[model samples]
Target: MLTGGPLDVLTGDYLAELTMLILGRDRLRNPDLGYAKTFLRQLEEGLGLAHERGVRIVANAGGLNPAGLADAVRALADKVGVPVRVAHVEGDDLMRLGAAEVPEVPEGPGEGLPAGASGEALAGAWAGALTANAYLGGAGITACLRAGADVVVTGRVTDAALVSGPAAWWFGWGPEEYDRLAGAVVAGHVLECGTQATGGNYAFFTAHDVRRPGFPLAEVWEDGSAVVTKHPGTGGVVSPGTVTAQLLYETQGARYLGPDVTARLDTVRLTPDGEDRVRISGTVGEPPPDTLKVGVTRVGGWRNEVVFVLTGLDVEAKAELVREQLADALAGAAGVSWTLARTDHADADTQETASALLRLVVRDPSPDRVGRELTGAAVELALASYPGFHVTAPPGPAQPYGVFTSALVPAASVPHTAVLPDGTRLRVGGGAGPGTAAPHDPRLPAGHGTASGADPLPGPGVEPAVPVAGGGGVGGSPAGPPRHDPTTRAPLGLLAGARSGDKGGDANIGVWVEGDAAWEWLRDTLTVEFLRRLLPETAPLAVTRHELPRLRALNFTVAGILGDGVASGHRFDPQAKALGEWLRARHVDIPTRLLPPTPEGNHP
Candidate 1:
């Protein structure tokens, strides 16, 4: 992109919950191998070009070792004959806090750690934690940029910091410029996921050529608003629908808390600027919580799984027989999970089509329990099981998986530092004020807490109304009953687009439509109760519904849906990447007027 378009700064995000654990393991094996090696390779090819073009590069590819990665970058610059000035932000690592000093894991909305876990359990987990890094904000990165660093790398900063940091530096935004900072934060979020803002993973992806969706960029102004667009001639698209989908991805409630500022998601407005460009404006911001989120990763336990193919007739009977036979062997395991996927068809079909799969997953602290014993038991059934007995693959030894938990600590307690290109370390402090643990805004009504079932925050341009007995309002406003328009039972995707993703153990599904009528219908119809009925897995979990009226969208956050975050592999879709698509596929009584016109000029 440096050569493709005019740019002042370029940023890359390469870290995730699982990646942090992997990097922690890498550091244990080799002291200097915690950063992303792929980033180094990319720099070898592009660093010279970026320097020649005077484009400052910011990336959180530093992973667990920003200092080490910074050194690596300097060495690569010398080798490539590029005069690049590199800096890194650090002070995010918290392993220095001994197990006894480690704080108890928080169990708020998106936090992945098990709720009500005992102190002893937390201590044990902390003692063995592979990593415990606080999520730092953009101040450190801004400091690095202002200090004349050509390249800035960071460890465990919020992903959006990659953009916000540069924008802050460029615009000279003060720490208290809540509105402007909030705008930058919103833009940062849209750009942080790379191609997602450009239609990758969009519910209506078929509408565009995403075969090679180009990365997205934001043109931020001094006032903090931005126009999200991609380079010309690039694949994929950047429209209001696409931008709205991204805005709702993995976020919960009206307040999107970050280390810097809490952005009001409900206040965000999106408008079409031009072809392949969406203007983002009017975002409200509030002071961030006094605490910072810390992610702690540890080897949870060993896990093993086996998939049994039950073919042709009596698939259920075959599955039951196998389950009964292996009951004794799996009884000793700490946790055993079974799933029966009936991907079978009756009469006149191919073998694959007529087969069902019964999968068994076991987890235990002892490797032998989940590995040797379980694998042996499953293998023994191969010869003695029901007719047409076959396994998808031979069961392998159990592999250790990580669990990610979140905790909050006073922002003042964590030191944020910037290592300059001149080898001077600068301490960056939170300029927002005294970092004392503050209660959530009490003015924010009850059921507005972090869990599922939380009420939507009042949205911009939406007036308060009496709560109706059933879901029929905007922002829980009593907008009366459903419209008396003709309706058709169809997939929700026919009238709306969606984007869903995992946030630790929780999953968020943001569904949106294009017109006012559709938005009103969606906000009134897709309540927490209705959602639970559609996706039964969410019935028992806490679900929060957030309305973004201006964006014509509703965001639902399902807590504890993924158990212990993506690293735990708790569900088939561990990261909940396709949850929105699943929701969109479910049939709903969509208003006929809201549906798009077919080629025959009729709504399907």
Candidate 2:
């Protein structure tokens, strides 16, 4: 914002599900420490300039304490000798209302199943309850903005609300404006992660200058259509590919649901307005769910882990020895687990080779058991353990783990409200009506088949199949002879760009091609069977694929890869942030025709 020139409003999104738990812990330690400290630090430096320029600020840095954050901002304004009107949106802290009062909602593929539920494997995860804050909407923020406040601090509002609130007030849109609100939501989703829309964490890294990519900005017009762009002379490229990648990032399914509106992503359209700007239009929105989603955090049990590395020959044997020793030492230890991962090779090479990791983790209801008993059992074998066995590091004191469960509360139960500078409280109503869960199928393109959520299947398309030489075309394509040049085994990135992220226990991988020629190959080549071949880890799990021809992208939903959400997941890529890059690295048979004739290896 410092270099991006004057702006009508500025929003900072600082809350995530994990962040809420962390902040709750902090609040437990010190009442005044719940709000994000970084936000205040940034405000101290920029508040004066922002106030001077009439740039309003809205942020969810108010974590578990919006009132406290508002007080700090007011104090800062006094210290800086500026008369600023600061207001905060509150009433999202559902713990104050009691847990039993809030009804639990059914968790879908996006939100992981609630602990102890039939489908959820990890029951009794949230035995010890902590803080539960409902994800809020923009009504309060918009009210604060309309009330002449210079800054609005909110607690746990949906990230998209920060942008939509200002846009709603600026456009004077009513509560029933679904399409326009959905369009604004698309803009907000792109800009919520700052530089993400400007090519940060993109699969095709070499295509853009990401060294110091500029932040994204949405120029929303009167009609709700927005042109996503970055400041001129920015480090990154803001093309259709980058914007679409950000759109698909971290989304649970095609329908982007928030407290304000449920956007139909498949219906949204993107077009190039000019250089470094993409026009977002044709977005349809539905009424938000009647119930508000709240993240419930509880003390999941105490846990400790130790990693032992086995080097050189007999790597597997060494791991087995360690496991055997641990099993003997902790014979009666309950909830103790060990995983032997082979990161070794047979051939002689550097020390990094022929090294395997034996990871041991133990959890118990009693913190003392995990802190002392678990650690002692592992250390007892240190002297008489397998040869070349070395611990990665000392196991620190057992730490408390948090289990996250998402539930829905009636909109009226929370009494959503906004507090003004003069102590005036304004009631903020939730959006129009009850929301409907949209059907999403990742196994096939929209027009090709059935979704898991009982969506009606579309009639089959009658496009002619292209002939290829190999009897087996990738993704089970029928073939006779070569239609293009000979095929070569290469990474899928040779022809496409990808973006991926996690939603609870599931991971969504969105792969897209630039032009019609590449897209034709991508849609046919990267089918569910082919994706399973590329990433064998997803082979055992149920995989769903969805095709968006308008964006020239195919989205695949990998189920249960992350055991749970980021908090207790055992996978190395817990959130599956790197799943896309890993898929791009997997080698595949690429038709030689897809390769560029140029030296730079750019797609034709």
Candidate 3:
């Protein structure tokens, strides 16, 4: 982006929940190999150009070891003859602490934790955790920048911190500047995932060119608002819809809590600014909570799977027979799950088309139990199994999987240190002000301590009722009268767009629509009860709904849906990336006015 546009800083995010676990394992084998190696390779090619253009770099490529990565970067710069000052943020690791020293989990919004999610549980996890890193704010990065560092490497700071830290340093923003800081947080969120804000994985991807979407950049101003855009002639297009879609990805509730600030997502306003540019403004901010979220990961157990293909006649009968056979073989397994996918036709043309798959997944604490023993059983069945018995691939030995969980620690407890280029260690304070505390206003929702026992909405500033364009009552929709507009049963995607993702063991699906009429209809129609009917799996889980009327969006969070986060492989869609698409595919009664015009015989 620096070569393509007038950029002052370049940030790269190369860490995720799974990456931390992988890096932790890397450190176990070799202490010097914990950071992302790909980042070093990228720097070898781009560092010179970045330094020549006076563009500073910031990244969270230092997965489990920031200091080690910092030294590596300095060595690479020296080898390439680039005199760039590199700094790193540390002290996020909590693995050194004993179980008794682990802090309790904080209670508030954004934490849609499942049952048994408590401080005691977190402490127990910490005792056996392979990796425990606190999610720090941007204060350390700011300290590094103020110390004249050209490159900043962080361990596990919030993803948005990359953009906010740079914006704070450039604008000289103080901790008390919550509104401006919050604006930077929103902008940072839009750009954190790189191409997502520019149309990658967008619900309406077919509406624009996204084959090779370019990375996104935010032009953050002094007041904290930013213009999200990419370089000229980039592959993707940026508009209100794209930006809004990104704003909702993997996020819960309207009050997006962070270490730096609590950004009011409901107050955010998006406007088009020419082509491939969207103006993001009006995002209010509140003081951050007094605690920091810490992500703890550990090896849960060994897991293995095998897929059996049954083609042609009696697919269901064939699947049942295999299930009965495997039930005895896997009886010794700690946990076993089976899924049958009938992808066959009665009078099919090709062998591939007339096939069904029966998958068996087994988990156990012992590698031998879930590995060779299970694989041997499945392989032995190849000769005695039903007709047309074939497997997709030979089942391999079981692999160790990781489990992710979150804990909260007092902000003052965890040290935030910045090792500057001059070998000077600087202590960075928390972003919350001296007397600031988590809000407990009665007007706030239930999770925030409201006394009315009413359902909790995310954050504050939620109006008692959403106002409709035409004269009407209140609440989710206009109560005065119901419009008897002609309706057709069609996919919900026809009128609304959705984005879903995982956060630890929980998953969030943010759904939105354009136009006031559509919003009114959606907000009223898609309630928790209705959603349970549409997606049966969510029926038994704890789901919370929050409204962002300003954005015409409703976000639903399902706790325990992902079963111990992405690494556990608990469900078919472990990350729930396509959960929204599944919802959109379910047929629902839709107002004809909300459906987009389409060519005859073509579905919307």
- Highest TM-score: give the candidate number: 3
RMSD in angstroms between candidate 1 and the native structure over all alpha carbons:
4.8
Using TM-score as the yardstick, the better of models 2 and 3 is 3
Model 3, 1-604: lDDT tens per residue?
A: 8678899999999989999999999999998888998999999999999999999999999888899999999999999999999999998888856555555544441233433344455556567778989899999999899999999999999999999998999999998798899999999999988898888988888777789999999999999999999999789878888888889988877678788888878678898899898999888777786777889889999999988999999888889888888777788888898888888877899998999888887888899999888888888888898998889999997999899988666677677788988999988886543323344434332222111223333233222242212111212332335678899898898778899999999999989988899988887788777888899999888777767777788888888999989998988789999999999989998988878897321321
lDDT of 2 by residue, 7-69 (tens): 888899998767877898898899887889899999988988887888999999998899999
TM-score of each: 0.90, 0.86, 0.91
Decreasing TM-score order of the candidates: 3, 1, 2
> Model 1, range 1-604, lDDT digits (tens) per residue?
8777888899999999999999999999998888999999998989988988899999999988999999999999999899988999998887855544544443331233464554455455456789988899999999999999999999999988888889999999988887788899999999989999997887777667889999999999998899999888889989887788888888875667888887877678888898999899888766776567788899999999999998999888999999999999988899999999999999836999999999888999999999989989888987899999889999999999889888765576577899998989998875343333334444333343222334543322122242212232223433567778889898888887888888888999988887787877887788878888889999888776766666777788788999988988899899999998888889988878877875321221
Clashes of 1: 5
The lDDT values for all models are 0.81, 0.74, 0.82
Query: For every model in order, what is the number of clashing pairs?
Result: 5, 6, 0
Candidate 2 residues lying further than 4 Å off, grouped into runs, are 98-127, 330-349, 432-486, 597-604
- The local lDDT score (0 to 100) that residue 24 gets in candidate 2 is 82
- CA RMSD of each candidate after superposition: 4.8, 6.1, 4.5
CA deviation > 4 Å runs, candidate 3 = 98-124, 433-481, 599-604
Q: Whole-model lDDT for model 2 versus the true structure?
A: 0.74
Give the winner by lDDT: 2 or 3: 3
Candidate 1, superposed: residue stretches over 4 Å from native: 97-125, 431-477, 599-604
